[model samples]
Target: MFYWFLKWVALGPLLRVVFRPQAEGLENIPTDGPAILASNHLSYADWLFMPLTLPRRVSFVAKAEYFTAPGLKGWFQKTFFSGSGQIPIDRSGANAAEGALISAKGVLGKGELFGIYPEGTRSHDGRLYRGKTGVARLALETGVPVIPVAVVGTDVVAPPGKKFGKVTRPQVRFGKPLDFSRYEGLENDRYILRSVTDEIMYEIMTLSGQEYVDMYATRAKAEAKQAEREAAAEKKAS
Candidate 1:
């Protein structure tokens, strides 16, 4: 109810008018059954822009921090994120990835659309990072087709470190679903998981046309923050 209200009543119409999103291959999404929408993470706006174009209700796993924020800001974050059909996953420690996989599988088992940013985190430099194998593991475990989606121009709408920005048009493209039924029983094979994840990432790369980076986005973000800190210290000394 809340999801529809927001999509049809509030944010959807406004975003469409502003972003003028160009969506493609939406038919590739199955009307029924479980499927994973695997996409490249470009910016924070990628979360809102991708789903805004989709006709069906798609749920994505979000960081737990968004739900646990303090004060009125926390209340707003919780309401907004929860109403948008996002599931909160604690992204910490060795068990975090496994926990996310469990939650994704639960969603898929219920025959719902599961959206995952295979890169694990938003790209700091607009380059598609190597995908973690959790996506592949989910697909293999659930026997669901993985749809490759690309979101363009969202980085401009909301760049990293900026609370808000001038409203700009963004585009979203969905690629044909990739079926890995051939590897139905190979979910436990690490080599197979790696191969499948690479293939999915390749399709996303083609759709988004972003440069591929082999490193994870989280690592890149840490490095970027370190650089900013060092620069600030240098400026202070000077």
Candidate 2:
């Protein structure tokens, strides 16, 4: 109820007026079934714009902090996120990955669309990174079609580490659903998982036209920060 109100009456219309989100390949999404939406993570605004283009609600597993923060501002934050179809999960400690998988399974079990960022984290430089195998594992376990999604220009609307950026029209494109039924029983095989993940990333790359980086986004960010630190140290020594 609140989701519909917030989407149709409150926030969706406002965003449509502001960013003017565009979409392509709308027919790729299943009208009434469970499917995993594997997307490239470019910016925080990806979720907002991607779902705005769909008639169905897309649910994502968000960090528990967004729902548990204290005080009035936190209330608004929680309400807004909840109304936007985000499910809260504690993304801390070793069980974080397992927890997200379970939550996603629950959503899919309900025949709802589950959105996942296969890159694990947002790209620091707008280049599509190698996808983590969790998405492949989930698809294999659930036996659902995996849709490759590319959300472009969201970084312009809301770049990493920032709440807002330049105003530009963001475009969301959906590629055809990928079926990995051939590897149905081999979900436990790491090789199969990697192969499936790579295939999904390739589709996303083709759609978004971003340069492909074989490295994971998290590793790339760490290396970038390390290089910055080394440069600073060398400057100090000089």
Best by TM-score: 2
lDDT of 2 at 164: 93
Off by over 4 Å in 2: none
Question: What TM value does model 2 have?
Answer: 0.97
Q: Candidate 1 has what TM-score?
A: 0.91
Query: Backbone clashes in each candidate structure, one number apiece?
Result: 0, 0
**Compared with the true structure, what per-residue lDDT tens digits does model 2 show for residues 51-139?**
99999999998999999999999999999999889999897879999999999999999999999999999999999999999999999
Model 1 poorest 10 in a row by lDDT: 160-169
Residue 96 in candidate 1, Cα distance off native in Å: 1.3
- lDDT value for model 1: 0.89
lDDT of 1 by residue, 169-201 (tens): 777889998999999999999999999999999
How far off is residue 221 in model 2, in Å? 0.4
Off by over 4 Å in 1: 69-73, 225-238
